[model samples]
Target: MTVFGCRICDTALTVPVSRVALPVHANQKYGNGPGSLAPALEPGTFAVNPLPSGSPWRRWAELEAGEAEALGWYAPRFSISAGPVGQVLLAPGDVHGAVIDPALVGDSACCGLDGGEPNMVCVTCGAPVAIRIDDCGLRQATWLDPLTTHVLEDGPGPHPVLDWADLIDQRPGIPPSEPGGGWHPMWAAAAASALAHLLAASGGDPISIPNHQVAKVFRPTLDRLLDPGSTGPERTLVLAGPDIPDTGGHFALIPEHPQTGELWPVAPPVKPIPLAWDAWRYLAFHRTPKPVGRSVPIPPEALPALLPGHRFEPDGQIFLSVLARLPEVRQPRLRAIYDRGRPYSYTYCSF
Candidate 1:
């Protein structure tokens, strides 16, 4: 664990926090009109997205000849972000010794940080050091601007290193339902991202997710999108994890560590598709009927959950965002499907 301090005054700005991989949904907007979101990261941990963030974007044509490959994007995008990198993340509540900049709080109807500009300043030096977002339709977090702060590298902090065994015992399961009567936003985002990986693993071949509950969430899209290829056995995706039993299958959808974003290791060398730990825990450990994201009020009244009503659709933007980063996306067969992703709005949807 390490503390973050002001570059000028050297005043400590946060509790000692450990590093973790940036989540796919850190910048995802959950609902339309107005809504609140849970914090993006746990209090004592932080994540850094190596990919660029924000705008002053550059299109493919604008990049210098070899710059596209260097930037890690192989496919064409409307525009690529050219913003600052190495911004440190923290839960909004973890921030201390900072004041919200009244001048910077956005004037949008959401009435909080719209993530347009820095909204918090370092108290010691009055430097714009953090962008604290608690606005509607956005993840709640505080991003310590990379250029304005520095880390205090000293002795290890008091936080303990939790292993897989400890996490399995300590972490609670994630219910698919949200308090506001929809799917858990994180669940929706993670599932969408994972769905993209499953598509890539399909290798342009047809695949089946064996679990009916899992099938309901993914199969509709799978059946509709993937062109059937010459096949002997269609690839199968089985749900497997900490204590979940997986019969022999072509692929396994396993839990990823929530803190470190590390994919769980499985044997027999079956390719892995990572699901969020909490969501996978609920699926693997609790084998009851699953709840649908739509039309069900939470505070359920029984044992077996009601059969899901609506076909689950992964967030389109999230699907494209995850898939666009894959090396396979360079293949024209795969690239065509990627082009059909509806999130971009500009892309014409075949379905």
Candidate 2:
């Protein structure tokens, strides 16, 4: 067994709890500061994607470098003795895959530092760290919630780590076997594709749920659900359709096309919700579903009724237009949008 240790403070740790095998996050500077704290994981537990299952020295180096910079901490330039070390547990090598090793040390090894509190830190760097090993070998469809179990009302089933090749193998669920319903199958596929595309573009090795990839997948899904004839779920309509449904602060999609004067589903522009800036928002353009920019140039007839007594002036359009162009992936812009107010004009279809 090889033990990992931090040279800075002469602190030594064993496998499953040592610097070598343990998950680590820096706590240096974030948005102008000296990071968060040393071994931020000491007081917390966090997941690490694409664990060091194989000899991914280069990948590990890159990850450590980037995370270190973000947290304003650096890896020590030293190696501790591997002997007298605790078990060296390897997490699943792939994010899209799974590891079904039951004895690989469950959550016991990654126990919280502050008397079981999830939040922890390294005494040396004060960065957050969580030493966990995922079962990447056991691939299966999963719910949108990453932490969810297989048998649930979540996203997909047996969602084994699917790649482009894998997509072709399975006969994707066809669009609602019957038309006139919300984004049933096709929407789900587009959403999935979009998510895959975004993840690839964002330099994400393996897509993480609720990440930019997921957001991309959400776009097409929203469009499908927005189709007026779509019967995806009246309940989901509150989150996807134009006019706010009675769902109350839930996500909705536009049912019809606001542009091109067609019934095609429109990809609603992602928006932040008020009061809950961290969440997404969806709104109606006219009586029809209008997802932010996805439904620009509201029909003259629908605009009046949709605005409902509001001055149908260019000012309102301009304000909404400006808001639509905000960046979704950018952290700062996203934060600002959330600071605004949540309204029927915004969409909240995805988690």
Candidate 3:
């Protein structure tokens, strides 16, 4: 079993209680529509870059071969259509080897858990150790703060690769048959987080994003927050993923290493504008609108696919969770952006 420990106190923080196959990405949401079902690909048969060579999907081919090789693309071991599967598990009590620091807790409307800050700390050293996220719509988990913990394996094991097939297959299962099924809180939080990153990437200038589904979801919030009078060359927000092309000068939403949580850049030479990997994966592959009243026409190239059935609600808890984690979001001007919209409310349409 792999062991994760606090760097400062050398205390064992967590150990895998068990290992199970889960959707390769954490933030993916599957759809209820039959056409939206995730495509199943055989192991080792998928392409490292899934987009067609002539596909207008962005310049992922521009990535150096060395960089692509370094990513070690592979297929996911489990399928989401089957059930709730995961590769690792740590029991609740074993999640943190210490008491959580109250000061690090950030506000969350979903489940009242601190999704923004490091809620767990090393008991012996009093150092922040993990983020306890038990939010209402999200799968409860304690993400070890990579900055504070060191993960060690028993031996020199093969490093895991980024599996394109796994990403395509592992979206959230069907929603509960309750009144108004669960809205993906993480999606809103991720969109809000991406918006903050986009602003930072703009270097204090106005920017335009492509008219993709992600853009549709966030434009309202972005328009409400950005200043109309700002002056600078217009920058575009591009989707960067394993298959999408390199982001030439555009602001990129790149994938993350599933195991280590490190982001992979489209252009390896430039600094990345980080978006959660699962968020980028969702934006890149699942572009169709959620199944609702009207049958939204799908682009000829962007065919219908299985995606999560949750209603698209801008979650305040997720927005705050994302906002608090970013340093750029703390700036006085950027900090005020959240207030520009109608005060975030539990009911829909407030943000």
Shift in Å, residue 53, candidate 1: 2.7
Error of 3 at 30 (Å): 19
Best lDDT among the predictions, by candidate number: 1
Give the TM-scores of the predictions, in the order they appear: 0.86, 0.19, 0.49
On TM-score, the leading prediction is 1
Candidate 2 residues 1-351, lDDT tens each? Answer: 222333333233222211111221111111111221122222111122222122112332445434433322222212211112122222212112222223333353222211111122235553322222212211111101112111112222122333322322342222221243322222222233223223223221221232222233343423322234533333211233222334332222222211111221234342212110001111221133455765457554443221113111111111222233233323342233323312321222221
Give the C-alpha miss distance for residue 37 in model 1, angstroms. 1.4
What TM-score should be assigned to candidate 1?
0.86
Stretches off by above 4 angstroms in model 3 are: 3-182, 247-249, 268-271, 287-313, 321-327, 330-332, 338-351
Candidate 1 local lDDT, 162-216, one digit each (tens): 6777877888667777655566777777787888888788777778776766776
Kindly indicate the candidate among 1 and 2 with the higher TM-score. Answer: 1
TM-score of 3: 0.49
lDDT of 2 at 291: 50
* Candidate 2 residue spans exceeding 4 A from truth: 1-163, 170-333, 340-351
TM-score of structure candidate 2? 0.19
- Per-candidate local distance difference test: 0.74, 0.25, 0.49
Using TM-score as the measure, what is the rank order of every candidate, best first? 1, 3, 2
